[model samples]
Target chain A: MADEAGAAKERKILVAVDESEESMYALTWCLKNVSVSSNSKDTLILLYVMPPRTVYTALDGTGYLFSSDIMATMQKYSNDVADCVIEKSKRMCREQVQDVKVETIIEHGDPRDAICQVAEKLHVDMLVMGSHGYGLIKRAFLGSVSNHCAQNVKCPVLIVKRPKASSGSS
Target chain B: MADEAGAAKERKILVAVDESEESMYALTWCLKNVSVSSNSKDTLILLYVMPPRTVYTALDGTGYLFSSDIMATMQKYSNDVADCVIEKSKRMCREQVQDVKVETIIEHGDPRDAICQVAEKLHVDMLVMGSHGYGLIKRAFLGSVSNHCAQNVKCPVLIVKRPKASSGSS
Candidate 1:
């Protein structure tokens, strides 16, 4: 336990990003706050976990599948979106805290499993995520992402919440 | 936004605690990290939001009334739990970081709304909480508490995830 706590002193922060505004807000908050001063030397990893793509099977459930061409097209689209989000996060890091080293990882799997697996594999000191996500229905799923990640991960998780429509909280 | 960011420089962290082990772990984690260094000077407010206890009401569509004695007993029980949790958290602060100013607030209402309301009212720099309160059934509710607090609160929220049964995570 002491060793685990000691390792935490040197921050290896992981920020889970998607195309959610909440996630972007969390990344910004982390840069301006959690990763500061001495923490600037720490690596802030931007992780984007894309759910494993599943090609649609035949309506008859007879093992017929989508054409390889269609499957490839969808896969390419997912990768493109991942790249865009990562690039935008990198820019935010650059603009917010120039010293903190930033890295990116794009994984394919259940986001809950992928995130916890990556964070554990990296032995990150902390897992930072945003509260909600793109839509109301998606927000509930994102909530599960954070909830599962929090329960499964070893390190402390910082879930930055995005203010509601009012923006009168502060 | 700049003014909000400026105000955040002085860390006013709030940790929401209950009788759950997960919450205790989170409070301990916050003491060891978030409230460290210059943050010691920053105030650490330990908040315990007790859900309003519903006293037994007479079963009728009319003016139902629970006996005052029964109501008083239940309220006292609720208050006792709140006090016990708060006292335990205060002890953690004393043992962990004596320099960090520790304060406590006990509020009776819906845990979700009460937490967000208190955080907004206090304009805390950050809100730290535990994930997965009791079990799977309770988790859905606690998830909403963290989710609601994160979405509704003004400050960045940290939901500390407790290690799972396997504990193979680094």
Candidate 2:
């Protein structure tokens, strides 16, 4: 088990994917870049966070009714989203990398927070992600996940840009 | 004229924009984050490369024959792209800055090389950009722009990540 962990101990790269073309570029880039040496496993962890939804539960006897089904359904949706991200990530990895272990994670909450949490938990050597465009007002008001991650995370972060038609690549 | 040049003194910022959403985010972030005092004029030089089109151009004489036109169009497009960027940047700077001028530059070359050259030519105080994700292969094979910029550029480089959603404005 120790040897397994050590052999699998490649640089932990946490890539946050939003399923955009930019995210896909990041994913593809990682598969091509990270080494799969025996001692340096270079594990790739793909993460996706679902935007949170607020549902009114109950208001005493005044005006609302609580529904367990709603919560259950939300959990199910979370799982489904995770599954989708994992499936897509795995497919991309298979095409680009061989004999490399890949892990997929899906979480429910703010994307930036979830990403930071995972990075800390996994002790990732570096974090890789695609930038999602958020304007100044929106970013100042709502905040940008990438900015937050860059500021807070202990590890170095790699943010990839989407390819342009003139960029000459798919 | 000297005063205008002095007033319009060039402040170099290594602006990296791909067709990616994150690159846009980085541009937006720079517009908001970079400070332009009354004494200093600022130039946000936008840099982009057409990737490796040499192969495709080699195959199709059409692509090669029209290379000059393509370059000219790219220059025009760069101007247009820079116009949009400066417009947005000006909007962000409206309240925060006064008497600060903006200049846009478009170059067709390797993104990293173009950035470094501009930084050197203008003797920039700092290099600011958004990160692009690169895993091992692409990083090893092509090299990451951020990493290369950090290693090659003499000035300090700032790499901004997107803000996290959960964290309130900072």
Candidate 3:
């Protein structure tokens, strides 16, 4: 019982990663800033949510159907991207902190919903993610993922914005 | 110097508190989850932004000239609320964490801009705040402070949302 109680207190921080440098910056920032506890009990979970593949039918307005070969190629590209991102994040964590435990999770769905559901199911202590910092017009069209997650997640959500001035340099 | 470098590495977490229970809940959550480092060098700053008081004059629409005494009384009321909230937050922090360094600051301005400015000025490692979780109708009327800060603040911003299911019990 005591052990369970102790285990429950261990922090599980989930960082939502994508191909963007913004998300990578957020991951690096979280490692340096939040994962440095002396006890090192905090576990960093790198989560990559693959956007659902859109299926096209003959009835669609475009009147074109994607062949299985093309679909397979697209899926392969996505898988490669996810693998590349997770590997880079893992290496960054290794370089930034010692004895910091990192776990990677790849999920498929709309990222906004998937991230929130994973955080809830895992009972993560905090969720760290990056802001796309979309302009008013862009946000109106694309909607902000970090904003959506911040509103929906059960745990606290940290949105890290890559500073405009430092964007070129980074 | 080595000391300066060590101090620079120390995390400065800024929590924006108002009279709202949501803000208090964020403070409590941050204390338990974020400020548990064994080394205890992380400094927790409790910042309270008092909304700018509107000055009334005869030229203003629907203006009834307020006497000096009335203005003084209103000022006193605002001050009292700030003091009360700060006191409660201090007590909660004391009860929750051991040897955690805390400092308090009071500023007067629009909370959205004031919080961003303060967080930038302090070079805070992260900003911890509570989301009002306003619905579309309410949010359209009153812009979200957490959302604004999350977008504008240079450092990371953690917006804690009070779960609706637990609102009544809390």
Best by DockQ: 3
Instruction: Assess chain B of each prediction and give its TM-score.
Output: 0.81, 0.59, 0.83
How far off is residue B11 in model 3, in Å? 2.8
Per-residue CA lDDT of candidate 1, range A115-156, in tens? Answer: 899999998879998765434665465556775775678778
Question: Fraction of true contacts kept, per model?
Answer: 0.42, 0.02, 0.50
Instruction: Please write out the lDDT profile of model 3 over residues B124-168, one tens digit for every residue.
Output: 878999897323454466598888888788777888766556555
Task: Flag the better candidate by TM-score, 1 or 2.
Answer: 1
The global Cα lDDT (0 to 1) of model 2 is: 0.58
Q: Summarize candidate 3's per-residue lDDT along A1-170 as a digit string, tens digits.
A: 11221232678999999888778878877776667646478889999987566532232336465666766777899899999999999998887788888999999877778889999999887899989732345446658988888878877798876656655553
- Computed on C-alpha atoms, the DockQ of candidate 3 is 0.39
Worst 10-residue lDDT window for candidate 2 chain A reads A1-10
Rank the models by TM-score, top first: 3, 1, 2
Q: What ranges in model 3 sit over 4 Å off?
A: A1-8, A55-67, A133-141, B1-8, B37-39, B55-68, B133-141
- In candidate 2, what are the lDDT values of residues B57-142, reduced to their tens digit? 55457654556667667556655755675555455445444554555555655667878888788766446665662223444666
If the candidates were sorted by their lDDT against the true structure, best first, what order would they fall in? Answer: 3, 1, 2
| All candidates: TM-score of chain A | 0.82, 0.70, 0.83
Give model 2's share of reference contacts.
Answer: 0.02
